[model samples]
Target chain A: MATALENANLLSRAILTTQKLRISVSKTFNHMKDGIKVSQDEHGAPKSFASQLQEDLFLINESFIELEKLTMAVRRQREAETIGNTGALSMDPVTDKTPLYPKALETYKWATRLREHSAHSQAFLNNSSIKRSSGSGGSPAKRRKTAPTNLNISTQAVDNLVMNVNRQFHDVKITKIQLNPTVLQVYVSRTLQAIIVLRGLLIERVLIRAHHENTLNDDGTLDLWTASKYEVFQKITEHATAASLRYYLPTMQDLSFRSFMHWLNSFSKLFSTPCRLCGKYIKDNLPPTWRCFRTVEPYHECCRP
Target chain B: MGVTCVTQWPVTENRTVPQAVEVLTKRLDALGASKSGNFGVDCETYQSVPTNVPLKYIHVMHNKEQPYTCYAVTDNRTCLVCENSFEAIMHRLNGFYVPKKTARIESKGTRYEMGDFIIKIGIVSLGPHARGVLVEVEYTPCVIIQDCWPLMVEFMQGFMGAQYTPNTHPMLANKQEVPFNAEDTVFQYLEQFENFVKRGSSTATVR
Candidate 1:
C-alpha cells in the first residue's frame, strides 16, 4: 500500500512536469517575439533577450528530464507490484479496486479461447479434401475460361426481363421502371403494390404497400422508403423479403424473377384468405401475411408455427 | 383511421337498456374481445338565437379516440373538423348561437379489441337518461369500406347475430369505394344521436 501511494505521487509529479514543459516552450516563443524585456528577473531587473531565451530553454530541458525520471520511477513501481502479485493474482493490484481489471481479464481469456478454436477450424479447413469445383482446383487461366460469363447484367437485359415477366403474369403489371438506382413499381392484381430495387441483376430490396396506399410521392416519383400504413402490409413486406431470398438463383435469374412474381400473385387473396391453421380472418392485428414458398398456402405469421 | 361502421342496436321489449348492453358485451367477451379501456363521444347542439335568421343546428362533437380534434357537423351534413380549441371559439359565439342544454347526448362505455377489430359497446344517453345502445366496429387494417366490409360483417355476426349485424350503413353505402376517414366516423355517430333524439323518451330510463 505504501508503494502504491508512492507510485501515484510519482505519476502526479510526471503530469505536473509535462505541464511545466509546455508552459516554458510557449514562454520561449513569446520571448522570441516580444524581445525579452517583457519579463523581469527575480531581482526586478529587466533581463536581456539572449539570457531570457536561455532561461526558458533551461526550464523546458529540466522539466522534460524530471518528467522522464518520474515516469521511469512509476513504471518500475508498477513492474514490482505486478511481479509480487504474479504468484496469486495475474492483474495489477491497484486496478483490482475497480471492475476494469477483472472485466479486461475475462475479455482477454475469451479472445484467447476464440483464437484457439478458430485456429483449429482453419487447420481443419486447409486439410479437408472437399473440392469446390474441378476447374477451381486447376490453373487460374483454365478456371477463368470455364467460369460463367454473364455475371454483370446489362440494362437492356433487365428491361427485357421486366417485359417478359409482364407478359407472363397478367396480374403483375410493371407500372414504372426508374434508372440510376433501378426500381420497379409493380401493381399485383388489385390487392397490393410492390416496389423492387435492383443492383446489377440482383433483387436488392422489396417493399410492399396496400393497393389503397400510394406507392408514389406527391411529385409523381416512385416512393421507395415509406412503408405501408397498415400492419398487414408491413408484415407482408417482411414475408416478401424472405420470399425474395428463397427464390434467389444467381445462375437462373429469369426463373427466380418469375417465381417471385408467382408468389406475389398469391397475395391477391390477402384480405380474402383466412389462415389455414386457425381459419380466422385476422390474428394479432394482422391478416395472413405469410404465404408458403412451395404450396402458396396462406398462414398468419403466428399460425405458421 | 380505418373503416368504421356505427349502428344503433335497438332495445327489445323483453330486455332493458343495460340488459341489452350486457348481452352484447357477454357475446363480445365470448368471441375473445378483451376490454382495453373506456371511450366516450358527446355532442352538444347549438342553434342560432335570432328568430329572424333561419334556424340552423351545429353539432359540436368530441370523440375520445381523437381527443385532440373537435368536429362541428351542421344540419346539412357539412362537417368542419378542427382543433379542440374550437370549443372555446364556439363559446365565444354565444350571442349568435345559444346551446340547447336539454339536447345534449353522449355515448360512453367499454372499448374492446379483438384481433384487428376495435369494438365499442356504448350506452347512448340523452341528458341524464339512457336511450339505446350503439355498437361501433372498426376493421383497422383496410381503409376502403368495400374491401373490408364483408370481413367486418363476418366478425360482427360472430357476436351480434345475423339479424342484428346490419348491412352496409346508409352513410357508407355511397362512399363504399372511397377510403374512409375520421370524419365519416363522426358523421355516423352524429346521425345515430339524431335518431335517438327523434325517437324521444319512449324507451329512455334513468341509469
Candidate 2:
C-alpha cells in the first residue's frame, strides 16, 4: 500500500514537472518569435535578450531532468511489482483492472517526443547567427591595425567634394558645410532647401524644406530636426533620404556625395514639373510630390505606384 | 503665414453680395477646396483726440486666422503687430484715441483649404448693412511674394476664371522681396476696408 502511494506521488510530480517544462519551452519560442530587443526589467536596469532566454532555457532543463528521474523511478517500481507477482499469477490483477501501465507508457512516449522537439529547437537556435555588436571580429591588436585605415574621409576631402559639386551644378548651391559631425546645407535653385548630416564619411540623415521656409531656428542656427511645414516638401524629404541610401558608396565617398547632389538638383523644378504618368499639374489637390531617382521625371504619389 | 493676396470680388449687375459668395464657394468646391471653417476679420477705427498732437487714425484689426495677435495700422501705413493684450492698452489710451463707433466693419464668411492654399471668401459689412465680397488667397508655404506670385496667380486663375488677372496688392508692391507676415495680410484687409468706406454702398467694379 505504501509503495502504491509512493508511485502515485511520483506520477503526479512527473505530470506537474512536464506541465512546467511545456510552459517554459513555449515561453522560449514566443520570445524568439518577436525579435529580441534589450528591455528594462522592473528595477529599471537594462536586461539583455540573451540573458532572459538563457534563464528560460535553464528552467526547462531543470524540469526535464526532474521528469526523467520521476519516470525512471516509476518504471523501476513497475518492474519490481511484475517480478514479485511472476510466481503468484500469470498477470497482475491491478495491472489488468486499471490502465495505469498503458497510461504510464503513453506518458513516457509523450515526454520522449517533447524532449526530441526541444532538442531540435535548441540545435536550430544555436546555429542561428545574430549580430549583437558593431565591432568587427578580431583580436585587439588586429583591430587596432585595421582601424586607422577605415573609410572615414577627412574634412578637407569633404570640402573639396562640395566645391567640385557646386562648380559642376549651377543651380545646386552648398551654402554651409560644418565639420565635427559634418552638416551641409544645400539650396537648390529657388525651389527647395536640403540639409544633410554626415557620420564620418557616410550620409546619416537628410532634411528638405521649401526655399521660403526658414531652415534656421529663431536663434539663427540650422534646424536639423523640424520637418517641413508643407506636405510637398515633406514628401520630397522622404525621397531625398531614400536617395542618400541609393547613392551610398563607402569606398568612394566623393562620388557618392556628388551623385546625391545630382539627384537632388532634379527637384529644382519641383513646383513647375507636372506628373509624367497623369500629365497633370495637380492631383488630389497636391502638385507632383515624387521624382524618379534615375530618370528625374516627376510623378504624383498615387501616380508613382 | 505665407504670401497673401486680398482683392474685392465685385458684386456685378446680376449677383448680390451673398449670391457672389455662393458662386465663388461653388467654384472653389469644384476646384477641390474643402470648407475648413468660418473666418472673420474686423477692423475698428480709432482717431487720436484733437490735442497738441496731430489727429491720426489707427485701425485696430483682428483676423480669426491670427487669433492671438492684434494689428494696429496707423494712417502713415506703419503697422504695429502685437499680442492680443494690446487691446487692453488701446482701452487704457481711451483719453488719447477715441473709437469711431460707425466705422466698425468686418468681413466674415466661409474658409476653404485646398492643398497648400487657404481661400477665404468674406462678405464685407459696415454696422448692419452688407458692403461687398472680399476674396483672400494665401499660399502658406512660400513667404517671398516674388517666389510664389506666379504659382498663386495660376491657382487663382483656375477658379477665378482665365480672364481674372489679379494685380499684386498695392501693399505688397514694395514687399515683393521681403518675407510676408501677418502684418502684411492685415494691412491688405485694412486697405480694402478703407476702399469700402470711401465708396459707401456702391458696388466695386471688377478690375
Candidate 3:
C-alpha cells in the first residue's frame, strides 16, 4: 500500500541510525580505557571518553540524520520531477533554506559513509584491539575470534622439557663418593648445578601437586598440574643449568648421592615426618610405639635409618 | 658488568581477551562514538594507544642468554651488571616484583641515563628531606611519574594478569631509596670498578 518512495526512505533511515550508534560506543570505550592514545606514553595527549563518545554518536547520528534528510529530499525532488513541478517542493514548508530534497541527499551520502564505518568499529569492539599490541606488529586487524580454549595438553610441554633436562644433566650419580644426606657440608661446585638444585625444588613441588589429585572433577578433567607449560619449565631449567655451568660447575661432592637423598627426604616430608609408627614423634631416633613393645624399634629401618 | 637485577619476562607484555574488552570499553566510552544500533564500538573507532605498555611487562626487544645490563656510575668510575650476573635479582624481576625507580632530577639535570649497562651521573638521589631529589646534574623520573603512573599501572594490571594486583602490588605510593646513597658512594663504586678490573669481573658474592 505504501509508495516506492516511502520504502526507500525507511531503509535509508534504518541504516543511518545503526551507523550512528556504533560510532558512539566505540568512542566511549576508547575514553574509558586510556585516552586518544589508549596505550601511549606519558606527556601524551589525553583521550576523553565522554567527549569521544559524544563525537562518535554525533558523527554517526549526523550521518544517519544526513541520510534521512537526503532520502526525504530525493523523495520530494523525485515527486516534483514526476509532476514537472520544480517549484512545487520550493513552496512546500519544510524550511525554505534547506529544501527537503537537498538536505536528504547530503544526509544520505554522509550517513552511508558513516554506516560503512560501523563495520570497523564493531570489529574493534569484538577484537581486543590487537592494533595497539607491542612488537613490530602491523595495523589493526581482527585475529579470528578464538576462545582461549586451547587443547588441554596431558603433559605441559614446558614441564616435560624441565623434566627431560633435569634427568639429563642432574640425574647422573657421581662416580665413587656417595652424598651423606644428614650433613649440610657438601662442596657444590658448578653454579649451573646449584640452580638445577634450586629449580628441582619447584619441579618436585609440582610433582607433589600432581600426586595430590585424589578425586576427579565432575567434568572429567583431573585436578592435576597438567598445564602444557610444565615441560617448557623443565626445558628452561635444563637450558639455564647448561648455561650456568660455564661460570661454575658442581663438584663431585656437590653432586654426591647425599644431596640427592636430602632432596628426596625433603620431598617426602611435604606433610610431616614419613609415616611415623609412634603416636606423634617423626624422628628417626624414636622407638616405634604404634602397637606392641617400644624398645629401639625403628621398624622401617632400611629407609628411615 | 655485573647484573644486580634481571627478569626472564623480557620486558614484554601479553594481550588477553577480557583485558582487551576492559580497555576497549573504557576507550570507547571516552570517545562517545558508536554505531547507531551496535552495543559498542563502530568500525572506524579503533585507534592504537601510545606507549600503552607498562615498563614492567614490556619485554626487551631481543633475547639473549645474558640479561639486560644495568650500570651505576660513581664519582670515580662506572660499574655495570648484566642480566646473567645475578640469579636472585633476575628471579624477582621475572617472578613477582618489578622494581620501579622514584626521585627527582633537580634543576641541574641528570648526569646519568639508563643506557647499555652504563648509567653515568654525578648525583643519584637528592638528600632525603630535599623536596626535589636530584638524579643527574638534574633529570628526574617523578616529575613525569604523576602523569604516567596511572597508565603504567593500568598496563601492568592488564599485562601482569593474576600477578597484577592484590596478588602482585604494582602501585608503589612510596618507593624506597637505593641500597647506598648513590651520591654518597663515589669512592666505593670507583674502588669496586678497580677491583673488578683487577679480578676480571665485579661479581660481589653477597651473603
Give one digit per residue, the lDDT tens place, for model 2 in A1-305: 57788888999999999999999999899998985777798999888888888988999899999999889898444443533533233245776776565666567679999999999998887577452323334454765775665456677777888888899999998955567778988899877788899876568899998886677789987678999888778888888888887777654666777788888898777666668997766666567777777787888889985
Candidate 3 lDDT over residue span A1-305, tens digit each: 24566667676766766676566666666666766644333657565555566766667667667666655654333343432445365456755666775565567678989988997788777666433222214332422221122222233343454344345434322121111111111111111012122222111211111111122347873333332122212332333233333222122322332334233222221112223343232222211112111222222222333
TM-score of each: 0.61, 0.62, 0.15
Model 2 residue B164 CA deviation (Å) reads: 2.4
Clashing pairs in 2: none
- Candidate models: Cα lDDT each: 0.81, 0.81, 0.31
Off by over 4 Å in 3: A1-163, A166-210, A218-221, A224-305, B1-207
Off by over 4 Å in 1: A1-151, A159-197, A204-231, A273-305, B12-16, B26-32, B50-54, B92-96, B201-207
Worst 10 residues of 2 chain B by lDDT: B198-207
DockQ of each: 0.19, 0.24, 0.01
What TM-score would candidate 3 get against the native? 0.15
In angstroms and one decimal each, the interface RMSD of every candidate reads 3.0, 2.5, 23.7
**Model 2: how far is A64 from its true place, Å?**
27
For model 3, state the Cα shift of residue B11 in Å.
58
The TM-score-based order of candidates, best leading, equals: 2, 1, 3
